[model samples]
Target: MIKVAFFDAKSYDEVSFNKTNADYGFDIRYYQEHLNLKTVPLAKGADVVCIFVNAECNAAVIDELIKNGVKLIALRCAGFNNVDLKAAKGRIKVVRVPAYSPHAVAEYAVSLMLALNRKIFRAVNRTREGNFALKGLMGFDMYGKTAGIVGMGRIAKELIKILHGFGMKVLAYDLYPDMEFAKQYDVQMVSLDELYAESDIISLHCPLTPETTFLINAQSIAKMKPGVMIINTGRGKLINTEELIEGLRTKRVGSAGLDVYEEEKNYFYEDRSDKIIDDDVLARLLMMPNVVLTSHQAFFTVEAMHNIALTTLESIKEFGEGKPLTNEVVEQ
Candidate 1:
């Protein structure tokens, strides 16, 4: 029986992985704490360590895991931005569930847009308080609107399809553009400048790399259409929170839908309602009515969770069998 250490373990994570492990039967120990220098000792005596988005898989943690004889790091999420791939390159194998359900995130992005557009949460509260007044709930039709999508990944492709059904014209920017997919989906492959200048809604679906950090800064916001809606289901570092707050304060950007925050690892997965949040940037975002903030839950659908558990367990089984890692993330 292979020993597995699971970090950042939530109830949902335990439920899914335990159910899936009935087949593979790997001994998985769940830890509520994150994978960091302090918690790395918990992984000792384990064959592999399973982590999620919030786990800190820095070089230090990687070194400790290697010292502990842990050979594999399995991430049950698509984004590996938190993982130090360079350090793990030669020492340990790193794998992730790249595409559990693109539809889950894409649809959640749409939900955020709808929530911001219609002021659904505010309305629900108003009705419950017997204050059903229809004064500030005006929303423009998505028909004939242009949506600019950054990073034409799987989630972006799914988002484009949904936007098209709403009679939206899609403009996309990608470092490696798929011309065939664009042509097939009636999307225009445009430059970042053009996408920013003309779009009513700007959606980010890019990864967090050195090149993409703070991609939505004040300079880029200045180029966008006034009152432009910004939706980010991508990594939190993709947008600068301070600049975004300024944009919202001045009404330069109309609304925002954020599922990820740069400093989310400290507070996202856990219940922090009882504690006073010390993150001022996040608190500012919470106060804004135009911003619909979610705790990185864009990929929390039951379907996606099941797939993630099954795929992660499968990868672990394959490694134990000494087979080729189909979903291994090789450092570029």
Candidate 2:
């Protein structure tokens, strides 16, 4: 039987993973704490180790895993930024659920955009206190508006379909152009500069890489249309939080709907409301009336979770059976 050690297995995580692996014929061990160099011994005879986002898979952790006879690293989420790819280049194989449910993330991005644009969060809070005045609840219609989408991936393409249904024009920018999909969806591929300058609402769905880190900075914001609404359901650090705050303060950015933040690992996936928020940037972001932030829940839907678990377990099974992993990540 193949032995699998799942690190960072919270209550929900175990429930979902077990539900999917009921008949997979694998001996699975769950650990509540995150996997690291010190905890690498937990994987002592296991063939595979499963991890999630926020877990530190640095060089030290990778070295320890290799010493413990671990062969594969299966990531339940799409982003593998936490892993040290350099260390795992030739030693162990790394696999991830690259595309789970694009609709879940795309819908959440749209929900954030709608909530921020219509001031829904503020309005709900006021009404709960029995203040039903419409003094500051003004919002624009989505019809005929132009939306800019960064990185035309699966989620971005799904968002384009929804935006098109709402009578909004879609402008997209991607490193590799999919001209066939663009023509089918009636989306116009444009330069990044044009996308920033002409879009009323800008959404980010790109991955996190060295080139994409802090892609939206002070200079980029300066090039954007005044009062442009920004939405990010992609990886955090894509937008420079300090510069974003400056944009919000100056009203250069009319509003923002963010599902991720640069310093989210400290606060997200846990409740910090009982204590004072230690991060000033996160605190300031919360104080903005036009800003709406969620705890990286763009891919938290039931369907996405199930798909992620199934795909991850299937990859583990394939590795154990000496079959080639269909979702393997290789270094160039």
Candidate 3:
């Protein structure tokens, strides 16, 4: 039987993985700590290692894993930005669940937009204290608003459908244009600059790469309409937090709904409420009335969790059977 070690193992991860591992019967080991260079020794004797989004699978960690006889690196999450593919090129194969329940994230993105626009967070807090005044709770209708989507992937498509249902215009920008989907959904495939200038709200669903790193900066934010709402359900590093804070200070960005942050590695997915927040930008953002932030939980739905576990194990099983790894990530 192939042995596998899972890092960054949470209670939910254990529940889902243990339920699914019964089918494959792999010798699965769970570690609550994140996988890093120092923790590579924990993976000794295991043929494969499974990791989450926050694990630091750098060159040194990959080298040690190879030295420990590890063959494959299976990522439970979709994003592999933290992994160094070049270091594992010839030594260890890497696979990930690329698309698992896109609706889970897509729906959550819409929820963020709605919650921010209608000031739902503020309303709930006031009501809890018996303050039922609607003075600061005024909101605009979404029917005539235009939403600019940064990517046309599966999650963006799902978001487009939801936005269309609310009678919102959809403008999308993608490296590879899908005219068929645009025509079907009544979405306009526009240039990035045009989308930035014309959109009343902008949402990022793109992956993190050299071209997309810090895609939302001062320059891009300058081109956007005044008081435009920005939403990011994609990778954290896509936005420059300092620039965002500046925009918030100047009221250039009316509001923001973020499920991820650029410096989220230290605080996200962990219970640090009892401790002082060291990240000043994140602390300031939390104090803002217009900004709504969630702990990278857009993909935490039951359906998505189950699919992530099933697809992850199925890929490992395929690798063991000498079949093609459909989700194997190759160097670009």
| Each model's lDDT | 0.94, 0.92, 0.94
TM-score of 3: 0.99
What ranking emerges by lDDT with the best candidate at the front?
Answer: 1, 3, 2
Candidate 2, 218-286: lDDT as tens digits: 999999999999999998899999999999999999999999999897878886778999899999999
The TM-scores of all predictions, comma-separated, are: 0.99, 0.97, 0.99
Instruction: Give the residue spans of candidate 2 off by over 4 A.
Output: none
lDDT of each residue in 1-332, candidate 3, tens digit only = 99999999999999998998889899999998899988889999999999988899999999999999999999998899999999989788999999888999999999999999999989999999999999999989999899999999999999999999899999999999789989998999999999999999999999999999999999999999989999999998999989998998899999999999998988899999899998899999999999999999999998999999999999999999999998999787
Give the range of the ten consecutive residues with the poorest summed lDDT in model 3: 31-40
Collision count of model 1: 0
Q: List the residue pairs that clash in candidate 1.
A: none
Residue pairs whose backbone atoms clash in candidate 2: none
Query: How high is the lDDT of residue 207 in model 3?
Result: 95
* Model 1 lDDT tens row, 1-332: 89999998989889998998999989999999899999999999999999988898999999999999999999999989889999999899999999999999999999988898888999998999999899998888889999999999999999999999999999999999999999988999999999999999999998889999999999999999999999999899999999999999999999999999989989898888999989999999999999999999999999999999999999999999999999999899
- For all predictions, the C-alpha RMSD in Å is 0.8, 1.1, 0.7
